[model samples]
Target: MNAPAIDARKWMPYPSAGGAPTTLYCLPHAGAGASTYLPWRKELQPDVDVVPLQPPGREMRMRDEPFENLTPLLNDLLAAMDGVWQEPFALFGHSLGALVAFELARRLSAGEGPRPAHLIVSGRRAPQHPSRLPWIRMADDPMLLEIVRRLGGTPDEILDDEQMRQTVLTLMRADLGVDQTYRYRPDPPLDVPITVLSGSTDSHVTMAELEPWAECGSAGVDIRLVPGGHFFVVTQRETVLRRVRHCLVGSP
Candidate 1:
């Protein structure tokens, strides 16, 4: 039978019919929620149990305050993860979520906590990549909005609706704050296999930035280039599904 669901306050499984032999924990991009990975169920079902980690302050927990720092955030994430850490599991993260997954993996690799069998990171550069700016969260409204718009980070539909526009901006700023404030230090490479995925046309991340991720893990890295921009996880879902399936199949 599927492990009983975590507090539902944190991790939400797609279809809730879990009890699969393996679990895939999906982390979301900035300003996104668990629902963002809902489609993953159709692509990875029967063989893999797909669960999305939901932090406070977004979607169903809209009333909660967003995270401005990473330490406390990671602590909270780990606490909520206690239940599902059982069995063979993998982690898949995109963009901001990728960084979170990497750091979490580092901690898990240290010991005590459960380490994932595989880590699939997409649309993000390696942790050691030098930072270009102090903090995008500190950018002025017009400047920040312009960057998000130019990068297609925020949808136009959300921008069109005043209420949603404000909400999106608010949550995005906090999420970006989490990213901006994060500082990566050198850590021993994880023993788990890593898969680095990126969009062919994603200007924010280049192939050079992705290759370094291979050095962060000892189990070897497989780089896959999907055809799309920054949001390839959405636009190239099938490619991601196939790649993840291939990774899981090859896992021990």
Candidate 2:
């Protein structure tokens, strides 16, 4: 199959130092830019390409209106990937991005696009589980910030700036809306394997919440619990990346 061309400006592809045979698409959490995963470029082995999805209203597409409705936004993402997916690849998503990856995987499995070799879903609960958190994204800035502070992800300095805070808040709200408004449409279990990871202490998703992810695929689901809270991927990055590398390469 011919490789689909990916527009460089739309999606950030961190090529391995050497020509890698596989690609790992990294989806960022709500309100984040592609650059959030830029550091992973240096963290992983050169043989694994890391591509971060960049939605509109941030980074290179700053002027473009952000996606409020998840359907069209997800379809657009599937289109972009279909255009450039010619090699073996896997997907890793955190928080809201986890849902995006799940939905995208569903789309790919339904269409001509390629299904991921392995799926790594971190932080977010399984799709079958209903979210219990209030609509914090719609809350006032002070209240929203309070919720975000507890969950952890955005930096303290960025939260301190009024201008940046509002800008980021808008993006975050839209991103969260994607999660809040989502209604799961059940599909058959995917043939691809899945590796589920979560923080041992994360209040956002309990072990029960994470279990449904296993039902999403036919392959045996391997679950890994790391130390820390929701954003443990930051405090425990090397550990996270090591697992990601394992999923991508099928070896530790």
Candidate 2 Cα outliers beyond 4 Å, as residue runs? 1-8, 13-18, 136-138
Q: For each candidate, what is the lDDT?
A: 0.80, 0.79
Candidate 2 lDDT by residue in tens digits, 123-233 = 989988866767855688777777767767888999899998888888877877788888887788878788888999998989999988888998778888999899888
lDDT of predicted model 2: 0.79
* TM-score of model number 2: 0.90
In model 1, state the lDDT of residue 84.
Answer: 48
lDDT of 1 by residue, 1-252 (tens): 975543645555343456677888888988899899888876787777788888777988798788888778777777666654746888889998998888888877777488889999999988777544436766776666766676576779888788887787788788878887788787778899999999999988978888889889888988889999999988888878888887886432
Over 4 Å off, model 1: 1-8, 13-16, 130-134
Q: In candidate 2, list every pair of residues with a backbone clash.
A: 4-83
